[model samples]
Target: MLASRNRDTNSLLKSEKKSLLRFLALYTSLVILLITLLSIFYYQSQEKLMFSNQRAELSKYAYIQTKRLKVLHYFFPERTTYPRDPRFKSAIYDIEYKKIFSLLENENIHFNEEIYRAGNYIHFVKLLDTYYLGTKYLIIEVPEDMAWKKEAWKQIAIGSVLAFILFMVFGLILARLFLKPMRDSIVLLDRFIKDTTHELNTPLSAILTNIEMMDTDVMAEKNKKKLNRINIAAKTVSQLYKDLTYLTLKQEQKDHKEEIELQGLIRDRIEYFTALANTKQLYFELDTENVIIHADKQKITRVIDNLLSNAIKYNKRGGTISIKLRIGSLEVSDTGVGIDEEKIPFIFDRYMRFNQSEGGFGVGLSIVKKILDEYHIKIEVYSTINKGTKMVLTW
Candidate 1:
């Protein structure tokens, strides 16, 4: 069932891809969230430090002006001139919150220690003693320039991009690390199957060849029956070996496609399994036309052999198998303990056996399906429990 194996491999790969994407997406989201929060914190801290330094500079200027005013009040008591600084706009207010003198036209200001931003200026307010030329509040306004904030944001953006790249690289590494064990186990299992199949080939061929060469005519009737039983058993093992070899070494097999007479091939395969069928007293009704098909002979033989083998193996004692071959189709119907409707869909799956009591690896239908797929053949199955199964293959 190369097709089935390929499908399984593709399905597994898709599942792994989804898992990798999910892990990467979740990890990227978390990293982005952490980076965003840290950037916000760094930006706030930088802004706070910048404002604090500006406020200190403004407070120094206010102190200088206050000292100058006290000196001017003692020297020229009647003059309206007050000490001023050219670095920033300044204002003086009375105890009733009324402005006395200001370089700015607007007098709206609050008496608080913290800095405030209004319009395009950084505002700072402080309380003054009435002894400093009767001024009760001093306010300072500095022009606000956001160049430092823009630079800080640019740095944060660059840092976030670098962090995302680093996390993606590490996430891929982590995903590979997590999948390593599973890959190793699959490789180990594949090696075991290949080795086991290789080992089984020689002994199986030897047994089947020797049994075929045996002289059953010279033996007593009872002994002949025993020999027949041995032949049947050997053939059963031989079929299993063939299925295993096909699954393991299918890629190595060479295809030689040629026109084949379907009638003769079906008859030959049926004869091959005659001994096995006789074990259960099964009979066959062949209604085959002399149809010709262009396909690999060995693969077509395998398809027919597996189907006949399953029909015989699952058939009741003295059950009749009806085989029909027409222009572009082949039908095999058997009086067997049939498969359930639900299980019919999975009948072609490797190692899927509905009847566990039957002695088989459950790969017969899977092999048949693969061979048919190569020829672009379609198969339909119909069955009723405790009744029979009818398999129809149409080109």
Candidate 2:
């Protein structure tokens, strides 16, 4: 039984570790995906805003040049002439802003029109014109430059660097803060369970011994009855000890199975609880085969001990405790207060007691669960309220 339990425990731990890793992986992947999407959206919007500002600046320049060209055209009316003020860009005209004979004759040119290209100005189409006809020609083009995008990129780099530094600093602090309380809680609970189990060992031994020392035939029936009460007390403590030890042992060592004789292990635990059973006049129906299973000895002992103890503890006086062991399986059944459907789900949880009046820390089933899980053994509990509980293990 102990060997089987250890095997169950180890296998369970491996699966739990695997599940935890997968969860972390999924969570981190989601965070990265969200950050990536937001970064892309932010950069695109920044690019658009930068481009808008550049276009506004170009439009202002175009307006100022338009006014300058109008003045130049009026002065150089009838013929093509070079500008007196060459600081600004201007299109000479013939007599008017339209009609023929500027630097280029009889040709009109369009300015401030989109030529979507790289240079600051597109071609000033006509370079020569004869007198009169007032021709308007010449156009300037300002192409989009990489400078606007470069500025946006710089801002993104600086912002992202700052955000990264802050996230690292706070993320570490947040993780430590969140995990500290949970770690402390587990450690304190483990220590308490271990210490309490140690305290119970001596008293429980004395009770069991004293009960054995009683001579039921010689004493009054009432005295025998009192002895039965003492036996119950002792058995309860023994169950508690087994459960606490089982829990602590898991923390202390890695689970490993050694070859064990299942039939012998089951019989020994039964005998250990035999005196308590006699006190209740409960019959033991142990049907076990000489099966050898590889598992941790201690954990297997705990599994059998917990189940037997629970059976005796909860059973009515003169009721029967049934224990069955086969290759790859074990079951303990009793005529006791069966669990309610709602409570069944939580029966195996640590510190969960269906009956607080029963003297125990409510960790027996939890320890059983832990051990079975390590061995890759599955447990299912069936019960009818106020009737009985049957806990089955399948490997």
Query: Could you list the CA RMSD of all candidates, in the order they appear?
Result: 9.6, 10.3
TM-score of each: 0.56, 0.56
Top of the candidates by lDDT: 1
Give the lowest summed-lDDT range of ten residues in model 2.
Answer: 99-108
lDDT of 1 at 231: 87
Q: How well is each residue in 1-395 modelled by candidate 2, as lDDT tens digits?
A: 57544544443443344445555556555555655676678888976675566556645554555555556657655634543323224344443445332322223355443323334432333323332224444433344457756876777668666766665555555554655564456546656766787787787778878788877889898887777777776776666776666665554577677998988888888888887788788998879888888888988888888888888888888898888888878888999888889989888877678687777777788778877887789999999987899999888
Per residue, candidate 1 scores C-alpha lDDT tens digits across 140-246 of: 78787788788899989898889889888988999878876765665455456567878888888888888879888798999988877888888888888787777
CA lDDT, every model vs. true structure:
0.81, 0.67
TM-score of 1: 0.56
Q: How many clashes (backbone N, Cα, C below 3 Å) per candidate?
A: 0, 34
Clashing pairs in 1: none
lDDT of 2: 0.67
